[model samples]
Every structure is written in C-alpha cells, then in structure tokens.
Target chain A: MTRPDRAAIIGIGYSDISRNSGTGPGTLIARAARAAILDSGVAKEDIDGVVGVYGSDSPTVWPGYVVDSLGLPNVTWWDTAQPPSIVGLSSAAQAVLAGNCEYAVFYHGKYRWGSTSIASKGDPLRESPAHEMDPTFSNPLVSHAGSLNWAARVMRHHMDRHGSTREDFGKIAINNRTHALTNPRALFRTPIKMGDYLAAPMIDEPMSLLDMDAPVDGAMAVVVTSLERALDGPHTPVVIEAFGSGLPIGSEGNLWPEADGLAARRAVASLFGRTDYSPTDMDLAYPYDGFTILTMLWLEALFTEEGGGPELLRDAWSEDEQVLKLFGRMPMCTSGGNLSEGRATQGFGSVLEAVQQLRGTAGDRQIGGSLNTAVITNGMAATNRSTILSVS
Target chain B: MAHTRRNYDTQPYWEGCDQRELRIARCADCHTWIHFPRGVCPNCWSDDVRHEAVAGDGQVVTFSRPRVPDGAPPMVTALVALDAADGVRVLGRLEGAEPDAIRVGMPVSLDWHEEDGQLVPQFVPSGGAPA
Candidate 1:
C-alpha cells in the first residue's frame, strides 16, 4: 500500500509551569487546549478529533472532556491514552492521515502534587494515595525501587563501565540551565556551574539534586493535521516525518542501563528506517532529560554505539560559552528540557520547543543557521517513543 | 519498615525467605530462572514454574548510597546479578562495607535479615575487595 500523507504540527500552546498552580489538572488542560486552538487559527467548529493523555498520577482529562470544554460540535474521533503525550501525538497523526479527522488536538497536563513532589506533603488537599510496594522487587528491609534510585544505579553503572565522571553528568545540567536562562517559561533559569552541580545535595548517590527534573503543575497541547491541509494554516507547519516505538524483547523488569539503551536504540533505528534523514542530517535534537543519565543514554543511542555517549557528551560541551552544542554546531534542548522546564513529562516540552525552533520563533535560544529537521525522543526502557519532525 | 507484600505469584519466594533461602522462579520447561517472579515463564510462557532455592552467590552490578531525611545513617543499596540465574538481577541493601569502599562488580553474598518479624534478603561483601 502507498504511504499516506504525513501529518504536521500546526500550533503549540502551554500553561506556565510552576511548583503550584492552585488549580486542578482539568482546568490546566482546558487552558492549554484553548490556547492551542487559538494559536492555530483553526475554528473550533472545524476541529473533528481530540486526543489527551491521562495517567494514574494526574487527574483524568479525557478527550471527551476537552471536546466539551472547547465546544467542538463536529467531533467524530476522540480518545484518551497514557502519559508522555507522544503516544497521543502519534495517535492524532495516524487519525488525521487515515482521514478519520481533519484536525485533532493532542494534550497532556501535569499536577505537581500528583507526582512525588516534596511540596505536596504540606498540602492536605493534594494528599496522594499511599505508596504501595512493588511485590516483585520489594523487600521488608530496603525501600530502593523508585525511579530516582533506579537512575542512581544507572548513573553508577554508566560511570563504572564507560569511565565517565560526575563532571560529564554535570555538563548536561549546566547546558540545560544555560539555555533555560533565555526561556521565560522555564522554572529554574539561574545558571549553574560545574561546581554547583557537583556540590548539590545528593538525593541518591551519584544522582544529585540537579540531575533530576523539577516536578511542576502545567499543561501542553499541540494541533496536528495532515501536512497537505496544514499548508493552508497560518503558521509554518512542522511535518511529522516519521514516528516509532520500541521495546527490547525479553526485557521484562530489566532495569540495567545496557537494556535501557537498547530499547532507545531500537526505537531510533526504527525511526531512522522510516525517514530519509539520518542522525547527522538533523539540525537539532532533544533526547529527553528526565534524568541526566537518560540524556546520556539517548545521545549514545542517537549518535554513537554503546559506551560512546560520555565521550560524545564531553566533546559536545563548549567551555568558552558554557553551553552544549552537539558536534560544535547542533544544539540540544534549547527549550531547557525537563531538567529546567519543570518536567513537562512525555516529551511534550521537547516537541513544543522543536516546533518553535523550526518556525524560527524560539527567541534567543534559536539556532543561527537554517534549522529544518529535528528529532524528539520520549520515555525510556520498556516504553520508548520517538519522532522525526522537519519543515521541509 | 515492612516492605514485602505477598501476592499469589510471589508468596512462595517470601516463604523461602522465611526459611533463610533466596528463591527465584525457574521455568519447568525451559529452566530459565526469573527474578521478580510472575506466574508464567516469560521466556517460554510456561505456567509450570517452580520456586527453588539457589546458592545466593552474586556480584554487585551497581550500588547507591541514598540520603535519609530523618538524620538516619545513609542506606547503601545494590543491584546484584545472580550467578545461577541467567539474566536475573535483584535489588537489596548492602552491608559490611562503607559507602566510600563500595565499588561496582564487587563480589557479594546474600544474607537474610529480620524486619518487623519478616525475613528480608540483603547482601554483604565477600571474597575480599576486588583487586
């Protein structure tokens, strides 16, 4: 069968990210959806589909709720999926391509107290459910199965096997902070130096406070439609060149760094297979910095072979500018990423930033040369989702 | 602090811990040892899996020293790759070594400790430090 027309992201919108929004997730979702609809200049009546991501951590913001909130009367397709909005983006793109809907809105919202935010402990209204132990890995003597603990182990493992140092991880933190300085939407904009990263309190050994993403309450949404139809829209449409997801076979419960990298590698390889653009052809890249170590693994998966990420990172750092320019030209996470962007989980923040850069609207963080192609990767280990976007 | 919760698939492993044994699931058909036990064998999809005790010899793949909030001593946790279980790793607290002294790939042997009247598996340095 001949391939269908590619879908394109026509507009992007997001609410301000903060430690506390003093609003429920449903309100945040509606605000973002309205902003995205207004930004796209697409009439509310023209929208035919809606897609949103909801997780156990965030209050449910189903697509039906979005349609009702936005008063989209002609909606024929709507569905809610899991978090990391890429999954929803992919679904919207597919629906548009198949002619199921002419225009679809994809959204994801995060609540600070819904996650493991320290600030949540103080608010009685934000009290989350009791933590239940994972029966498979839990022991009565140790409580160390959480994601932070897993990242700590992965960082140590990467250092042990690849001869990378804490400074290498520090470079990622500094690079993000430097970019975040220009991002008005970023939560932590103050620049951090290598010393600050190294001196930061260690939450879990090897993974310092700066190594993790800041949890915040916010929401992001994007309007996706067929590339052909998007050409008539107001903004420059960023085409979804290709999208793919992958998981390593027989990798159930395998938290090893090697296995984690393999999953990303598989996803990226599948992604590249569907597109003409190789890793070197991209003008910018966002490899998901939910943790510093994840960015390291993603860099390796995208550019080099295994055990090569640290060296690539080391070379990407520019001491003269105190910023990271991959291979001395291409920039990563110009929107500050999750590290500084207040953890807009599921790669939504990256996608939004990529769209901005491709449209030459990233303000001071924009790349100098002609920016055409970009890659956005989300999730890790078991659920790896990737997409290649371009303004060709 | 009590952490282990018994489920139908993992009850046998907890029972083995009570007997001072480290048990993992082994497929009756493919003989593939599985950690984080599920009812069926992931490798072969065989429901004829049995919980069996192993020698509990392993090496630390990696470790972390997480800070405690209540001014308690830092906890050192390690992920161990079991010797007999192919491609199986387990998380446990590491004892008998200081945080500064701990290193990746250090030889460790499993030991059981009592937590709230329940036996929980842990690891300690064995065969001296790596040269």
Candidate 2:
C-alpha cells in the first residue's frame, strides 16, 4: 500500500496547440483522449476510468458529454474537476492505485479566448468566499476580475519584504520565453530579452502584459495506469513517485509570501516527507507558469534552501556560469509553460511535457543528458499541487 | 455592474444593506463573529447567533487595480478587515481615493452605490465617510 509506484503515466497526447482550435471543446477532449490511448498502445476496451478538468471557457465539456462523445464504454470511474487544474490527475492516479479502474484517462480542453470578458465567477472577482464578506455586515463589493492585480499586490509585498525588483520578474518572463523558442507548440516562439519584458505595457502596476499567460484554445490528455499495465505500453513509464496537494494560501494580510511560499513549503514537506527523493535528485522542475511570478514561487517552494527563490531563478537563467552554478543543474519550465505555450491546456500540458522529457522525446527543447525525476505543479495559489515523476 | 441575489442565509445582510445599515452575525454564547452570513455559528457549533449593526470602520487588507477594458472606469477594489470583528473581512470598491494612494492598513468606512436597483456597499477613506 505504501508503494504508490504501482501507478504511472503511460501516455501523453494533445489536440492542436494553437490560439484557435476551431472545434467544440468535446471534440478536442475526445481527440486528445484518443491520441493518448493510441500512444499508450492500449485498446479502448481496457479503459474504465476518465477524469478531466474540462472547459475553463465553457461548461459544456463535462464528463457526461465527454463519455458520450468519445463512446467510452462503461466508465467505472469518472468525474469533473475545477478549471486550471492539476489535482485532477492525482484523482486518476489514486483510482489506478486503488484498483478502482485499470486504465484512467485524465484530460482537459478549452476554446480560444477571443474578446472573452474577464470578470467572471472563478476569476479574481470571487476571492475565496471566506475572505470576501465584510464583518460589518455590509453589502460586499465585487472583487477585481483578473489575476494581474493579485499578482502585482503579491509582487509589491515580496518586493517590500525581500527587496526583489521588477527585474526579477522580468528575468522569469525572459527565461520562459527563451525556452519557448525551442518548443514548436508554444504560442510565442519569438525570443525576448529582459529589456523587452521591462518595456512591456503595464497591465496592472508592476505587472506588465508580458508577465501574464497568453490565453488560447487547446486541449491536452494523459493516460495513467498501474506500472504493470504501463510496462506493456509503447514508451517509458513515468512513475508517480510522490505527490503533494497543499492548500493554497491566497493572501496573507496585504503582503503575499513569495510564490505563495507557505503552500509551496507545505507541498515540499509533504513530497520530501513521503519519499527519499530531494530537489537535488530532480532532473527538472515544471513549476506552473500561468504567470511569471508563479515560477519564482515554485522554485523557492521546492528548493531545499530557505531564501533566494528570486535570486536562484535569476541565476539559473543568467548566462554567467558562476551565477548559474548556484542552481546545481535543475532546469525549469521546459515547455515554455503557460505564459508562452498558451494557457488553454491548463496544468495537464506540463504533465505531458514531463512524460516527453522522461522518454527523451522532447526534440529541441529537451534538457539533454540523463533525465530521471521531474517536479510538476499546478498554480501554487488557490491550489498548490506538486508531483515527482521519474523514469521507471 | 453590481448585483445582489438574496438567498436564505444572505437575506438579512441584503436587508440591512437595503436599509443603509451595516450588520453582521455574532454568536450569543461565545461572542464570536461570523462572516458572509451563515445559519449556524462556526464557533462552539452554536446556532445562537443574531444579526446586529456595527461600526462600518475598518482597514484595508489588500487592494488591486485591474484594467477593465469596457465596463467600469478605472476600478480599484480591496479586501478590508473589520476593526472590531475577528476573522471578518469584506470586499469592496475603494472609491474617493486615488488607486495609487490606496495602501494596506489605511482606515476606511462603508458607503453605498446603486446598480441594477441593488444597493452595493463600497469603501472610502475614513476621512471621507459618507453622510
């Protein structure tokens, strides 16, 4: 029961990776699920589980719709997850390990955000219900719509405490963009300098347009099965060594802990506590990059060191070999992340990237040399979920 | 635009807002304050809670100014922590103050605005309390 290694991600696949998918969300989810099943070399009859964080843009892409559209026969385990999800995959993994289902398909799909209005239910407009009501018993004010303002406030708070600068955030943007150039599926392949990030127009004070996720229309899927089942698959199985689903601490007072550090720290503790693997054992860290600030937070949260999340990120991307040595050879966000790779895939895309890395199939953007362990995360705030994946 | 949808638990708060008064639920036994209008007390598992008016004064916990392209003009909002209420926070627009001037811990008082025939509460600098 202790060895969760019984579960592994055997297949990774996706629909079109573009701004405009030109198809219904159900179609996208089905196509990606089909590709994943095909890639796993598993017959559709062997599949009995389906879990996905479908439709950040539309609710029509629910489990029932997907089950019906994909013609999945007798799904024993099926459920829908909240949008921008990373924890949904854990549910699938748990189902596999528990023997509730033999093969589980975790997938998500969404349409391009063309002139889509920002202020909506799950956005910043609703601040974790607990923090939204006034004790004075007055009518509550509608909160702001986007993450930019929240991110800016967190940045300002981080700056106030640690003396981190806009340049630090710019460095993260530049690093993700740098990796994007090598990822053909990335929405933005053009290389950008730190100067470009600093010069970008301010969407919110201290947060420029460059610091945000480029919304797009796309879908991604991954197949999770028992190691016994995965061993028979077409590619190397990425073992789910350990995982931590920490609660997100939205905002502490006015200042945010750097990278939602509290949640990241908790997730780190849970991860390292369960397994012998340390951050040093990791070949890469696929911290969620819905925004540049998150990447900084993830690095700080997962690294064994106390402070210097920002400093480490800056050095990791720095061309100076002496400064880069501080990171000890852990590369990050190999898929260009959501910032450059398009936000529609949610966090499932990162899992797909981790599979590609472990199998040594990541063409140009590959990290090269020995690839073993990867640390993948959903956005740390609201939900802090991280998983350690390694070649089995 | 502001809108109010009254449910079984939230009716009292909305009713208080309709009367231009600020009210919150307090547990009679433990004297604990509950936020967002819940039926039972979160403290001591007591249902002995009643809605009562309180001073609308509070301090800003955090504020953000988002770029709303089409609807509102230069919106600045905040999560405010009540002065005397424990663990009670409210979200409101920070009106009558420059977006750049808003900071955490700045004193604020409740105010009101109307949208779609619904009264929505807002926050302003304590110095500019609404009459």
TM-score of chain B of each: 0.90, 0.89
Candidate 2, residues A1-392, lDDT tens digits: the string is 34345788899888777644433334456667777977998876677677777434432343433443444544545555666656778878987775446688888765433324343233322221221232111233343222325666666556656677888877777777777777877889887876787889877665679888877999887778999999998988889886664332222223233426666676676666667888777888777777666666677777735457767766676654211222757777777788887889666678988889999999987787898888887765434557789995
- The runs of at least 3 residues in candidate 2 whose Cα sits more than 4 Å from the true structure, single-residue gaps closed, are A1-149, A248-260, A304-307, A319-328, B68-73, B128-131
Candidate 1 clash pair list:
A84-A346
lDDT of each: 0.74, 0.65
Lowest summed lDDT window (length 10), candidate 2 chain A: A128-137
C-alpha DockQ of every model: 0.18, 0.17
Q: Which 10-residue window of candidate 2 chain B scores lowest in summed lDDT?
A: B1-10
lDDT of 1 by residue, A210-329 (tens): 999978988999999998899999999999887754444333222365656766787787678777779988999998898898898889989998889878888889998888889988
Off by over 4 Å in 1: A1-148, A250-255, B1-3, B127-131
Docking class of 1: incorrect
What residue pairs are clashing in model 2? A137-B23, A259-A297
TM for candidate 2 is 0.69
Worst 10 residues of 1 chain A by lDDT: A132-141
